[model samples]
Target: MKIHSIEAGNFKLDGGAMFGVVPKSLWQRTNPADSNNMIDMAARCLLVENGDRLTLIDTGMGNKQSEKFFGYYFMDHIYDLDSSLKKAGFSRDDITDVFLTHLHFDHCGGVIEKKKNDFYEPAFANSTFWTNKEHWKWAIEPNAREKASFLTENIKPIEESGQLNFIKQNSSFATQNEMDFDILFVDGHTEKMMIPHITIGDKTFVYMADLLPTAGHIPIPYVMGYDTRPLLTLDEKSKFLNEAATKGYYLILEHDPNNEIITVKHTEKGVRLDKSLTFNDLFN
Candidate 1:
C-alpha cells in the first residue's frame, strides 16, 4: 500500500475558533494568526493506493461556491481538486472510494462540482462515496450551529448521483478488512466522525480529521471551538493520545499548515508533541 499527501490548497480560519478555550497567547505561539486573527490552514487530503482501489480521504472545499460565500472563510492560494489529483499522478476517474471523515463543507465540498448554470454533479463519477449512515443523517439535517457548514450543493448531488454508500453503523470500531483499514468513530467534533486508521507495512497512520487537527492540539485541552461536545472531545483525546503514544502511531494532520505527520509521547503533564516528520520520512 502507498499513501500520497494531496494538497487541495490553503485557507484561513479564525484562530479563536480553531482552538476552543485555549487563549490566543497560547495557541498563537504554535499557529500564529494574521492581522485579521485568521490562521493559515491546509485542506490536506490523503490518497490511499492499495492494489486496484484508490481511496481518497477528504476532498477539501470545492470551487463551486460563490465568491461571496468563500470570502467569509478568507480562502487563499486556492488549489482545486482536479489539479491536486493530477499532480498526485491520478485523476477523479481513478478514485474507487471516497472516505469522508465528515460532511463539513470544507471537507466534502470538492466531491461535487458545478455542472451547468445551476446544476451540480459528483466530481468523481466512477467512485463510490463512503459516509456512515449516522453521519449522513446528521449532516443532511444539520442543527442551527452546524447548518452553515453543510451545504446542499456539496451533498445532495452525491445522493442524487446514486454513487453514495454508507459504511455499516457499528457501535464498535468498524474494520473494513477489504479496504485494509479500520475506522475510529469520534463524536466530539461531530456526530460519528470516522477517522481512518490505515496500516501500511509496520506503521499505522491515523488520519487526524478534526479529532486532533494539529500537533498543537496534542496538549489535551486544545479542543476546537467548532466541536459540539467539547468535554467529550477532551475525554476522547485523552484516551486516543495515550494509545497513540503507546503504539507510536503516525498522525496524519488534515488542517495543519506547516506540520504534516507527528508522533506523541506520554509526558509528565499528559501526552505532548514528540516530533514532527514528513510523508517520505515514513514511506520512503
Candidate 2:
C-alpha cells in the first residue's frame, strides 16, 4: 500500500482554542497567529492506494457553508479536494472508501455539498462512507459541547445517498483487502475517534488526528483548550507518544502546515520532535 498526503485546503481558527492552556507566546512561535488571534489551520487529508482500493481518510471543511459562515473562518488556500486528488493521479470517482475519523465539520464536511434548494447532498457518489456506530450516534445526537462541530447537513446525506457503512469497533486488526490496520480509539478529542496505523515500506505511519495535532503540542501539558476531556487527552497523548517512541512510528500530523511528519524522541524536555520534515523528505 502507498500513501499520499491530500491537502484539501487551509482555514483560520482562534489560536487560543487551538493551543488550549499553553500560552500564546509558545504556540505562536510554531503556529503564528494573525491580528485577530486566528491561526492558519490545514484541512489536510490522506489518501491510501492499496491495490484496487482508493481509500480517503478524511474530507476537509467543504465549500457548502454560506458566505457569512465562511467569513468567520478565513477559508483560503492553494489546495482543494478535487484538484489535489487530480494532481495525485486520482479523482473523486476513483475513491472506494471514505474513512472518517469523526463527523466533525472540518474532518467530514467535504463529504457533502450544498444543493440549489439549500440542502446538502453527497459529493462522492461512488464511495462507501465509513463511520463507527458509536460515533454516528454521538454526532447525530450531539451534546452542547460538540453540536457545532457535528453538522447534520454534512452528515445525514451519506445515509440518504445509500452509501453509509458502519465499521464494527473491534480488538482484532481490521483489514479492507490486504491493507491491514489497527484502530486506536481515543475519546479525549471526540467520542471513538479512530486513528489508523498502517505499515508502509518497513515503517508504520500513525495518522495523528487531533490527539497530537501539531509539533508544538508534543509537550505533555500543551493539550488543546478545545478538547472536551482535557485530562483524558493528557493520558491518551502520554500513552500514544510513548508507544510511538518505542516503536519508532512516524507521526503524520493532520494540521501542522510546516512539518508534515516527524519522529519523536523521549528527552529531558519530555516527548519532543526529534526531526522535522515533509512526507516527501521521508520518501526521498
Candidate 3:
C-alpha cells in the first residue's frame, strides 16, 4: 500500500481556540501566532493507494462557502485539493472512496461542492463517501455548540446524492470493510470520529485527525477548546499516547501546518514529541 499526503490548503485559526486552556506563552513556542493571535493550520488530507482502490481520507474545507465565511479563517490557496491530487498523479474522479474522520467542515467540506445555478452535489461523484451512522446522525442534527461547523451545504448533498455509506460502528475500534485499514473511534473531538490506523510494510501510520491535531498537543493537558468533552479528551490522549509511544507509530497530523508526521517518546513529562518528520522524509 502507498500513502500520499494530499494538502488541501492552509488557513489561520485563533491560537487560543486551538490550544484551549493552555497559555499563549506555552503553545506559542511550538505553534507561534501572529499579532492577530491567529496560528497557521493545514487541511492536510491523506490518500491511500492499495490495489485498484484509491481512498482519499478527509477533504479539506473546499472553496464552496461564501467569501465572508472564508474570510474568517484567512485561507491560503498555495495548495488546494485539485492541485495536490494532481501532484499525487490522481484526480477527484479517481477516488473510489472518501473516508471522513468526522463531519467537521474542514474535514468533510471538500467532499461536496457548489455549482452553477446554485446546485449542490458530491464533489467526487465516483467515490463512495464513508462516515459512521452515529456521526451522520449527530452532524445532521447538530447541537448549538457545533452547529456553525456543520454546514448544510457541506453535508446534505452527500445524503441527497445516494452515495453515502456508513462504516459499522463499534465500541473502541471499527474494522473498515473496504479500505486496507482499521479505524480507531474517538469521541472527545466529535461523535464516532474514525481515526484510520493503516499498516504499510513494517510501520504503522495513524491519521491523527483532531484527536492530536499537532505535535504541540502531545501533552495530555493541551486539548483543543473546540472539543465538547475536554475531560474525556484528556483520558483519551493519555491512553492513546502511551500505546503509540510503545508501538512506535508515525502519527499523521491533519491540522499541523509545518509538521506532518511525528513520533512521541515516553518522557518524564509524559509522552513528548520525539521527532518531527515530513511526509516525504518517511513515506517517500
> Per-residue lDDT for 68 in model 1?
89
Candidate 3 local lDDT, 90-160, one digit each (tens):
99999999999999999999999999988998899899999999999999999999998999998999999
lDDT (CA) per prediction: 0.88, 0.86, 0.90
lDDT top scorer = 3
Overall local distance difference test of candidate 1 = 0.88
What's the best-to-worst order under lDDT? 3, 1, 2
TM-score of 2: 0.96
**Error of model 3, residue 252, in angstroms:** 0.2
User: Highest TM-score, which number?
Assistant: 3
**Against the hidden true structure, what lDDT does model 3 obtain?**
0.90
lDDT (tens digit, per residue) of candidate 1 on 1-284 = 68899888789899999998899999999999989999989999999887788899999998888898789888874676788789889999999989899999999999999978898998888899999989999998999989989998898998999999888755322234444488888999899999888886678889999999877788889999999999999999999999999999999999998899999998789988898999888767
Model 2 residue runs over 4 Å out of place are 171-178
lDDT of model 3, residue 23: 98
Clashing pairs in 1: none
Show the colliding residue pairs in model 2.
Answer: 20-225
TM-score of every model versus the real structure: 0.95, 0.96, 0.96
